[model samples]
Target: MDEKIVFKPIGYIKSPFEDVKNMPKSTRESMDVEAEMIINEEYLESMSSMEVGEEYMVLFHFHKSEGFKQRVPFMGNGPIKGLFSTHAPNRPNPIGVSTIRITEINGNVIKFNGVDMLNGTPVLDIKDIL
Candidate 1:
């Protein structure tokens, strides 16, 4: 039998954008956007050695975006294309990645900028952007 897939969220993201529709299409467009991630206790030690001014690739789960379609309408255009061709949230797995600069790190919270994710997103992991 095929093995079951599983994941444990290491943190949860906090962002200003509550509605996905209000968020800019990409993080590049939201230059001044900021977000905070509350790392779970189990993962706090993993971030104990991180430094400010460094960039990290944050992997997260899209907790709110539901359902997936093989084809979707794009940019208000007429032709429908495969969902893989675009950044639409509908996917077999709704994981997300965003690179952001680390600004501050408290006991269990890490603050960063260059945000595109909606509030309360589950953070799967973080890695150096290099």
Candidate 2:
């Protein structure tokens, strides 16, 4: 494996959360929050298999996160712990994964829930929640 890797966004999130502080602290807390995934036209064909009513694992880029601390407060206010032990956005690789439900799919747009991301966060990929 390479020491570094890169990726391009397959889509972007459209949500009411414009700021991190306003977004849900945990993925479960955002379970019912409505949001849209605006897929790129080039990837429309690939999205054909995405079924509505199914749960998916969404991987996204945490573009707004700053530097990480080796020890960060768990849950943002709990005891400080190793970064690996916490799901903090600030990390060496600012990638975030959330389990979301697929409520609707219209053309290249997917209307889903369980959003803990900001409005313009880049969606890296989607996988079946197995």
Question: Model 1, residue 20: displacement in angstroms?
Answer: 1.1
Q: In angstroms, how far off is 14's CA in candidate 1? A: 1.0
Model 1 misplaced regions, further than 4 Å = 73-81
lDDT of 1 by residue, 4-106 (tens): 7799998899999899778866668765877899999887789988888888888989888789888987632447888877666767789878888888899
- Give the range where candidate 1 is weakest over 10 consecutive residues by summed lDDT: 72-81
How much lDDT does each candidate structure score?
0.83, 0.92
Query: Residue 51's C-alpha lDDT in candidate 1?
Result: 85
TM-score of 2: 0.94
Clash pairs, model 1 backbone? none
Estimate, for each residue in 65-92, the C-alpha lDDT of model 2 and write its tens digit: 9998899999889998999998899998
TM-score of each: 0.86, 0.94
Clash counts per candidate, in order, are: 0, 0
